[model samples]
Target: MKPLVAIVGRPNVGKSTFFNRMIGERVAIVEDMPGTTRDRLYGDTDWNGREFTLIDTGGLELGSGIPVGQVGLTGQPGDLMDHVMSQAQLAIEEADVIIFMVDARSGITAADDEVADLLRRSTKPVVVAANKADNAERRLDVVEFYGLGLGEPTDISSIQGTGTGDLLDRIVEALPPASEMEEEEDENIPRIAIVGRPNVGKSSLLNAVLGFKRSIVSNVPGTTRDAIDTEVEFGEQKIKLIDTAGIRRRGRIGVGVEKYSVLRSTRAIERCDVALLLIDASEGLAAQDTHIAGIIHEMGKGVIVIVNKWDIAQEQIRAEREGIYPDPDDEIQSAESYRKALMGALKFIPYAPIIFASAKTGYHIKSILETALKISDMRYLRVPTSRLNEVVQEAVRRHHPAAVTAMKPLRVYYATQTRVNPPTFVFFVNDPRSVHFSYERYLENRLREAFSFYGTGIRIFFRARSSKEER
Candidate 1:
């Protein structure tokens, strides 16, 4: 519950650059391109031990009609101005204080005046920041912003990090006192993280499941910038659904903002009990898709693979129905071929259940909630000590561990369930170092076969135990 401070300005006014400077990280995408950032991006930072949450918002532009041409002062494009304005307005509503940024190099323009007037009626503490004033020579440019009536503009450079310390001090002074902030109680609920690359229908799937427009959906890739959490009741169970920003490959992630989005998505995975890993059905599996699935495996979280946009794939098959398959019965064979290819590509997480869905048409969408609940229950399944040891003993009898040398052979004395929620087990062995990865994997497979761990990952550990302790 830290105090909220939002950075607001027109397109390409160095708002994101200033945001990155304040947060001390490149969290926002900073390109010369206007409207690159379409959603509000948030981060937390402390100034002189006082902490606050900062929101970097898209450029605010008003008017209902399609914005034509470019602004005279900044010469920045205004396409998608309405959406960007909506994003900014939402940020402003959630913020405790507002930092209105203007371009120092280009000087104030008509757009700046419009934003200034908007802030005047809002009744919030507003700070005017004239950015790109790298040196004392451009300090005179900030004088023009004084006309906005928000007081003298703070001369600073987001890129060079000049005059920002004073701006931080001013912002901290304007924030609400610590006593006024309220603390939120922790809730024990199942959190499902919807994760995938951009344009993979992750947001669409969420909207489909919710049966309403809970999140803003657009054809634009990366439309959802922040990790938005929504709580819903499914029968008697209350579940938390976290809709995260689309994660792009590390190399393709643009400078500043999009990079921070990937970080948020990764954090969501760490917090969730189960993850819905979505892949484009028409495009099939890409290397990045595999990369995302690997992350879920490495995190030891339960997962469900969703092949989204299945309707598109279905249509493609129908169009070439006669050409691809002479017999109508062969459609089943063609479908199996598609599923088999996905299995081969994602062999690492063979435990995950795959569902072919179309968010656009609501095909197989309802099953996702039921499937996630089942997987979550499996993740927390605990096995009794006696049963666990019996499984381990049977596994050992089937295939003995290889000997370290001709004279010394590996021996497992006993095993016990150490924990649940990923179902960890510890095996007491004569020599822990003698156990190899292949043998460990084999034991995991044996455990999976004996028990229905369905959609969750399992962990197995080996520990050396002396004969005296065993006796």
Candidate 2:
């Protein structure tokens, strides 16, 4: 269990910069403009041997703070500042410790003073950070924040990495001790990560499932820069829906934070129980989708193929109609053929169950949840050693491994299930190199056929047996 510390303040107050600095990574998108970070981005941080999760929230404006009883912040009628204030108020309620960041270079603005007044009423411990104090001149400006009455302002530069240690130390001290509620213990909770290229409705699907606008959905690509987790109980099952950054192909990623985001997404797949590999139904799958699916397969995580924006897809199909398909069933068959073609484009993830969904319209969203639960169940399946051996023998008998270099035939001595989650199997063979990739695929297919391990990725390892060990 780790304490939850939320970084809160007005827009462009260097909150995202401070968050990225505290996490020791560029988990949040740092932009010069305000209102860039619309949703709360969660990342883990360790300070003084105490680990905690940090949440970077949208900036708060003045006077629009929602009352405590509402689900979240309600926008005020008057101006933009009011909406920002309401969001900040909502952030205060969610945080265990609030790191109220302000710009020292700009000195204190009226919005800062208004947010400070709101923080004064919060029961949570607050650490006022005067960011962008990179030099001695700005350090004097840091003193001006004391007028807010929240105590001393810790001057630090988030970009230059100056004086952040003291700020983190103060933050750790202010954070409540880690508790059991923060720790996740449920093995049955299906961790489904929603992943896709940018602006493909990954966040929208998450929001639809939660039945609220949980993650920030914008028309802009790359709006979501960090992975966000939200738990929802869907149809008698508890699922942890993870929305990850839209991943681009390795070569296409420019340098800096965008590249780091792709790396983070790879790590997210490794940690997740199942990956909801989302693709734009209207645009269809691309080379990047195959690359992402390959990562999921390599990690041996269960996968569910989510084709988002299906409503748009239907309209597109209707526009493309020709005299070739006169009947409705024929049109459906044509659409199914088109889907199969898309699946062919993403052939790397052959085992994943594909579902058509519109995250915006909430079309077939329930099926997505059902598919995730099925995949999670499949990942945890355990086949008995005896059953596995029988399947292996039958498979080998049906299709033997090809002979290596025309010298000797590859013989599989025995096979056993090595792990349950993701269902890994190890086969002892006469020569590991002699066992070809096609043969491994054959064995996996056979195992799936025998045990019904559908919607789960399977891994197979071949170990060469020494002469002495064989004897």
Best by lDDT: 1
TM-score: which candidate is best?
Answer: 1
Q: For model 2, how big is the CA root-mean-square deviation?
A: 9.9
| Model 1 C-alpha lDDT per residue in residues 100-184, reported as the tens digit of each score | 8888898877767766767777777888889999877788868988899888789999898898998988898888888787534
TM-score of 2: 0.61
lDDT score at residue 321, model 1, on the 0-100 scale: 70
Cα lDDT tens digits for candidate 2, 107-210: 88877887788889888899999988989999987889899999999999988989889988998888776664345547878788988888899889889989
The 0-to-1 C-alpha lDDT of every candidate, in the order given, reads 0.81, 0.78
Q: In candidate 1, which residue ranges exceed 4 Å CA deviation?
A: 1-188, 321-329, 404-408, 466-471
Candidate 1 collision pairs: 28-256, 28-257, 29-256, 29-257
Distance from true position, residue 272, model 2, in Å?
0.7
